[model samples]
Target: MNKKIHLKVNTDLNATGEVLSWFEQINQPPLSDKKIWWQCQTLLIEGFANIVEHAHKNLPLETPIELEVLRLNEYIEIRIWSFGQAFDLQQQLQTKPELTDNFQERGRGLKIMDSIAEELNYLPIDAHRHCLFLKIKY
Candidate 1:
C-alpha cells in the first residue's frame, strides 16, 4: 500500500486556506514555484469551493469533507471525497449552458481545472458519495 497523508476539515472556505497551508508546510520547496504552485492551488481551491458551494451548501457546518493527498510513484494525487450530492463532471461539461454578456460568469472554473490538472474526474460510486480526483504531474 502507498503511504498517504490525510487531512480532514470542515466544509468551510477557511478550510481551503488551511489545506494550502498544509501543502506549503510539507512540500520540499514549500510551494514556492509560481506556476506550479498556483496551478495546484487553483485546482484545489476551485474543487474545495465546489464542495462548499454545491455539495455542503445545505448541510450543517459540522459535517466534514475528507481530503487526501498522496505522493505516488511519479505524481501527486489530491482526492476530495464527501458524503454529499452526486455530481458528474463529464455530464456537467456536456451541458450547453446559456451565456449572456451580463452573465458575468459561466463555466470558467471547471474549464480552468480541466486545463491545468493532468487528470480531473468525478466518481459517483453511490447515491450518497462523490469523489473529485485532481492529479498533477511533478
Candidate 2:
C-alpha cells in the first residue's frame, strides 16, 4: 500500500502537535510497530523543532514550513521545506558542531535522528530555502 500526506504550517512551535496528528493519520505499520512508530515520531518532532529553532529563526515568523510524507512499500519518506539559508549537513556531521533542542544536551537530538533515519539529506531548493529528507523503513 502507498499513502501520502502533505501539510503547510507556520514556523511556530504550535504546529508540531498538528504535524504529529498528521503523522498518525497514515495508519500504517509505522504507527503500529512501537519501535518504528516512536522513531518516526521523534524524527518528525526533532525535524520540525530544528527548523523552527535554527532554519527559520531569522526568517519572518509567518513564513511557511512544508512537510510531505510518503509511505511506500519499503520505507516512509519525509520531506521538510524550510526557508532558511542552506548549510553543509555533511560538514556539520564531520565537524560535530553543538546542537541542542528545547534544553536537550548538545547533539543528542541529532544523534537520535541520524541513527533512526535510514537516509537523511538536506539540499537547497533556492537561494534561501532548503529541503530536508528523512527516510525510515517501516
Candidate 3:
C-alpha cells in the first residue's frame, strides 16, 4: 500500500506546528519504526524551518509553502516547494560552517538533514519556484 499527503502552509514560523502535525498523522500505522519516524520528523522540521527562516525571509508571511510526502514500502519521500531565490543544497554541503561555543543559535540544521536523509536533492523549478526533495529509508 502507498500513502501520500500534501500541505500548503503560510511562511509564518507558527505554521511549522501545523505542518508537523500533518506529518505525524500520515506517518502512523504501517509506518511504525520509531527511530526512522523520528528522523523523518526531524528532517521535515529542519527543512521547513530553513525555508521559513532563510528561503522566504524577505517574502511576505502570506507566501505559500507547499509540502508533499509519499510513503512507499521501503522508503518515504518528502518534497518541499517554495518561492525564493534558487539555492544549491549540494554546494552548501560542500562548505561546512564552523560551530561556535554558544550553541543557542545559528547553523546545524542542514548538517543534520544531510546525515539523516538517504537521498536529498534541490531544484529550481523556475525563477520563483524552488523544490527540495528528501528520501528516508525505513
Candidate 4:
C-alpha cells in the first residue's frame, strides 16, 4: 500500500466535483499514458456516482460516503464505503446491456464498471456498512 488519500463526504450528488477534484490533485504529473489516467478517473467517478444514485439513494442525506484512493506500483485501487444494504455486485455485472436495447437513462453503471476495472468487488464492512472496490492496472 502506498500513501493513501481519504475523503468523507455527505451522501449527496453535489459532492461529485469535490471528489473529482480530490482525484485530480493526486494526478499531479499525470500518468505516462493519458488514456489510462482518463479511464481510471472515469471509473472512479462512475463508482462514486453509482453509490450516490443506487446504494445511498434512500439513506439519510447526512450519511457518510468515504473514498480511499491508493496508487500502487502498477495499479490504482479505489474503495468507496457507504452505509447501505449490501447487494450482489457479481450478479449485477452479469447483466450486460445489449447493443440493440432501447435507449434508457440509467442501468449502465455495472456494465461501465465491468468494462473498465481490472477487478471489481463488493464487500460488507459490518452489518451497517458496505464497500465497493475497484482496481485498474495502468
Would you estimate the TM-scores of all the predictions? 0.81, 0.88, 0.91, 0.92
lDDT of 4: 0.85
lDDT of 2: 0.82
- What C-alpha RMSD separates each model from the true structure? 3.4, 3.0, 2.0, 1.7
lDDT of 1 at 7: 79
Q: Write the per-residue lDDT of candidate 3 for residues 11-44, one digit (tens) a residue.
A: 9889878998899766767467788988999989
Best-fitting candidate, measured by TM-score?
A: 4
Name the lDDT value of residue 25 in candidate 1. 40
Evaluation by TM-score, superior candidate among 3 and 4 = 4
> Ranking by lDDT, best first?
3, 4, 2, 1
Per-residue C-alpha lDDT of model 1 across residues 1-138, encoded as one tens digit per residue: 244677788888877768888766445544446787678778878888888878888988888888887765556678888777776787775563433322446356666677789999988858887888999876
Model 2 TM-score is 0.88
How far residue 81's Cα lies from its native spot in candidate 4, in Å, is 0.2
| Candidate 4 or 1, higher TM-score | 4
The alpha-carbon lDDT assigned to residue 47 of candidate 3 equals: 89
